[model samples]
Target chain A: MFNQMQLDILKEIGNIGAGNASTALSQLLNKKIEMNVPMVRILSFDEMMELYGSADKKVASIFLQFSGDLTGNMFFVLSVEKASTFIQQLPGLDQCSFVLPPYSEMAISAFQELGNIVASSYLTALSEFLRLSIIPSVPAVSIDMFGAIITYGLIEISKVSDHAIVIDAEIKDPFSKDKNGFIKGHFLLLPDPDSFQKIFSSLGVNQ
Target chain B: MIENGKTIKVGIADMKIAKAPDKLRTAGLGSCVGIILYDLHKKTAGMAHIMLPDSTLARGKTIHMAKYADTAVETLIRKLEEVGVRKVTLRAKIAGGAQMFQTASKSEIMRIGPRNVEAVKKQLEKYRIPIIAEDTGGSNGRTIEFNPENGVLTIRTVNLGIKEI
Candidate 1:
């Protein structure tokens, strides 16, 4: 139950956070990265799955849970191909294969670190902007079905409502000329239902 | 007569029924559980993709019956009965309930997979239904399909490929 103004505020928050994350990523890989304006939508569980292509689509996801003034879950999701591409960019991991399990420890760690850097930058920007103390848990990496990984973030929200407020930011690598771009990923922010009040109050906006 | 070779899909917090020559399927079960209540004699089955353990946790105005283990089981059984299937002849097969991400935090929400499995078992016991088979409590996501005609449940995982229970 959010008005247009409230939704705009959340979108702006996503925009700033994603901007910082893309900058961090570009620095790490020495590649030009582009991010679109974040989209804020309240959607049902089924609709949320569809947004990511489908429930069974395989993905590489980095998950983190944040606590403080505004508690919520954050996800950095990439397609299997995109994940491998990013992983290969890391030093000495050019031969890493992320297509199947029994994945090498070095590859996994490299991917995790990549996620860690980008997510930390994103959260840092948000924390500064909102003037809220936010602490993020250690990043956890998983390669699985998109629906399965993403639904983990929905557990807390599902208790309160069937619908969730998803702030989705899409980031892409500009160098690749593929039909869908070279490296594309999504940073999804799902704040717990109770945390909405704290966020609104911090912004001096009535919910 | 049944619709041959058609699969009825059950979405998260949703439910559906299928008859002989037809199947019921649900995809991407992370910490969620999929429960199937079927009657062999009637060649019919009902499936629910449950997201939470109980309806009491619902803070919203309207409760989605298929979203909770307690309510989903009851509602599925009732729906199966409406299709001329006897409650006493009903058997259950369940799957999904995975801890997709490993975290040091021991919050109850983090262990929801096991909790969901337990809640579903409790509901089935309350209804006097015997569990025929189950594939649960792994740290991997599962896509499950149930064939009412042959009473076979098929489970697929990203790492383990596919298996039938």
Candidate 2:
């Protein structure tokens, strides 16, 4: 049950998770970055089904895994145009071309590295906040279909449980990790409902 | 683009761009909703491009700080009032509410355009400001520019292939 306390707990959890995610993405990009997590709320399945528009394009999709001490599966969906935007902003990859196929491997590596960082950081933060340990499964990266990618995660997580808590966090990707940087990326946190509450409570907010 | 005139570049969702006649001449609008609220009486034009539906969901105050439909419209009206724009004389023309990005899920987060459109319409009625014209919805981003005196609206889109919905 995601009561008031739970919402607060989830918000804090997202902040920590986003930090970890930023660390990972920053390393891969070889540039300092920051994450700005937005407010988290528990939505019904119906709400999730509605509201969002369809895919803008089929070119590039960003994939990640959402794992915690509890249970949940979630993926990140981004367009190639967006990915291009991200890559273009990311450092080191400055030499990389925006072309496809050959760049696919580079893109996958970036995604996986980001996944590992965020997953590890989220679990680590949740464990510290709850005083429990969590280990995320190995992340698999690919570039095919957005529907297929999101659907696969939804199914994989659903198989283990029916009820899940999602934390919709928006991260601000700063070109430089240090101060004097503008927000350039969004970091989202999708957690299972149970743990989501615990984390929210810690933030001192009603769930 | 640089010029003697002031150009306030409005961003996605609930940000208003306003400048005095000798100050602002152009304001850029994107996929997000842009409510061009003007006062013919005062010759003042104020624009707000909001991303989300309401500010209730927001955490804190933003720089431009018109995060919600109701609040943004209210603020614009208040500003116009200060500049000697009469309430009855105030009118509006809205543009940009494209579903720039679509997904099979169709989450409420993306339907922001329609929801924002509705929110703005409701607020306008509450303020008693007549919406003379509006071009919203569909799947294309738009750029709108308005000159306070002439009150002439120049609308443009990215033209990503398909016609705007």
Candidate 3:
């Protein structure tokens, strides 16, 4: 079960993970694609979908997934138009209109590769702190929240556990210019029921 | 067009179909569903590019009045009926429900694309609206055009099914 200190450890682990993710993105995008410190919250499915209303679901699901002592998931969503625009406008990226540009094989591969880097970075960060090797299951990428993507992820995670702590963050760099810089994200942890109760106790204690 | 209106009419999201100038209407949508019902003829055309099926479950902002396959379809039917579209003229043309999200979630979890499609079909049937045309189930999201001017529904997604449903 996770306590205040344990959650802090998890948060630090997430911080490192997302930091690594941003580094990979900067390199991949060939620009200073910066990411902000992630905001963390534990939520039910409905709350999660509500947040997406602000984004564009007509796009595909771009995110990363990590699991070990904890699970971290992130979404880099874009509306179909925005995704096409981003990919087309993705400065350093090539403009290969292979059938559908954003939904092409290259796009999914690139997205998965990004997910791997970001997810691995979190595992790497968590390992550095948790001192335990954390290898995530293969990243599960999807089109949008529309299909079974969102529900299934929640179902799968909730089946194995009780709660997921989601971290939301915008991917932007004030220092440089990456207009295509997106809102990438990562998760701090998704603990079991025991862990959730444990964190609940800690939250009360901290307050 | 409403200039920073509260209406969020993104693809695969909320879609409202009305004639004249209503605050809630998006002319361009694809892969998402296109709905039409006559509130007077009682006719209404509503479409939601729902990427998911059930709102009772999921993570990170899953519940929008316009994003669920079940809610949007049923809501449109009821609203049109309330305005007076008879159940017969209420025959529908639905499109979109593309597999926009193709990832481990498809292989590992339920296929929401098909789920939403089937859910809409079932819901529409419950109202006895024979689906006259349906272009759905694919990998691309959709753009739907509903002319409240004539109640004509035109849906355009990508690849797979590319006809007016």
Candidate 4:
């Protein structure tokens, strides 16, 4: 349970991280990208799954593990369609045949780099803001059921606590005005239970 | 594949019991075990989606009993008994305890899937419930559907296709 002020502080952290990541993404795609307000929620395992609506939905995700003073997990997730679209538009990938479902080697590496850029941008922002050394592990790419991938991420924190602190930022493609047509992606961070204390203290909070 | 029957969904850290002509389903299980208890005599089934190996690892008082292997096994046994299924007539089948990401396998937490399988097996043995079949311990997520009518558990995965246990 976080106080209003604490929640605001976390939101501010998300804003800074998401802003930096969005800028990097715009450069990557050479297209203007937009981001919505970052939201921080304390959710149970069930609620965490609910955030994605349906667990069976296919998704392409890049996973990263955080090490150092503040341990956590982070990922950048996009729908399979959006991931394909983003990859096909890459400088030299237009001629590559678009495969279905499971991604090809070329696609995997491409997504991994995208994930690295986005996740590192956020981690770098956190490191600067909190003044703590936070190193993220190499990115691992997976294209599978959304629920399965997310469940994999939650296992670490679920061992220590029933609820997880999720900082979620929704990234949108500004060029597409159609709600459904726009490529929607999620940048998520889940700090371990012990790390929360360190994070709050680093932020000058006494929770 | 959608089965033609009343299907009850068991979400993450949840459990459910279904009678014959109905099915119990749980989706997106990764590093989490889906334990199914079947009663041959009464044609009843109970499923629990367990997340952790032990209840002691829980941070707070036992709030979600179904989320742990130890408590969930005991809870499912009780649920089956209440539905007129005798302990002697019960058999178990489990699936899903997958290491979804390979790079994270070096971390102990990433291997929780296999640990969960071991814990569930231990609990089943304690209750004298023999495991009939299982499809677990891979690096992939699974969606399972348990039908009490024929006492079949169908396990579906992204890369491995579908198999019935």
DockQ each candidate and list the results: 0.78, 0.02, 0.12, 0.63
Cα-based TM-score, every candidate:
0.95, 0.47, 0.60, 0.92
Name the better of 1 and 3 by lDDT. 1
Q: Flag regions of model 4 displaced more than 4 Å.
A: A95-99, A175-183, B1-5, B159-161
Candidate number with greatest TM-score: 1
Which residue pairs in model 1 clash with each other? none
Candidate 4, residues A44-162: lDDT per residue as tens digits?
Answer: 77788767666766678888889999998897888776777677768776544222644467877887888899889989998899988899888887777778888767877876677
Candidate 3 lDDT over A1-207, as tens digits, reads: 445675564455457766776776667656676666666667654455445452223335554444454443445544343334334435444562323434576665665566566556655764665454455656645554332234334434443333455555445544432254333233334433333343334334331
Taking every candidate in turn, the Cα RMSD to the unseen true structure, in Å, is 1.8, 11.7, 7.2, 2.7
Q: Local error of candidate 3 at A24, Å?
A: 4.9
Write model 3 residue lDDT over B86-150, tens digit each, in one string.
55676666665555444554343335456667877887777787777676776554445554434
Query: Would you give me the overall lDDT of model 4?
Result: 0.84
lDDT tens per residue, model 1, A1-207: 788889899999899999999999999999988999999989999988767676977888999989988889999998877888888888999888777887888998899999999999999999998899889889999888889888878888987888889889999886553355432798999999988877788899989
The superposed Cα distance between candidate 2 and the true structure at residue B106, in angstroms, equals 5.2
Highest DockQ: give the candidate number: 1
For residues B78-144, write the lDDT of model 1, one tens digit per residue. 8988888989999999998888877787877778988999999999999999999999997899999
lDDT of 4 by residue, B1-165 (tens): 456779999988889999978999998888889999998667799999999899888776545789899999999999888888888889999998887777744877778889999999999999999999998887777889999988899988776678999
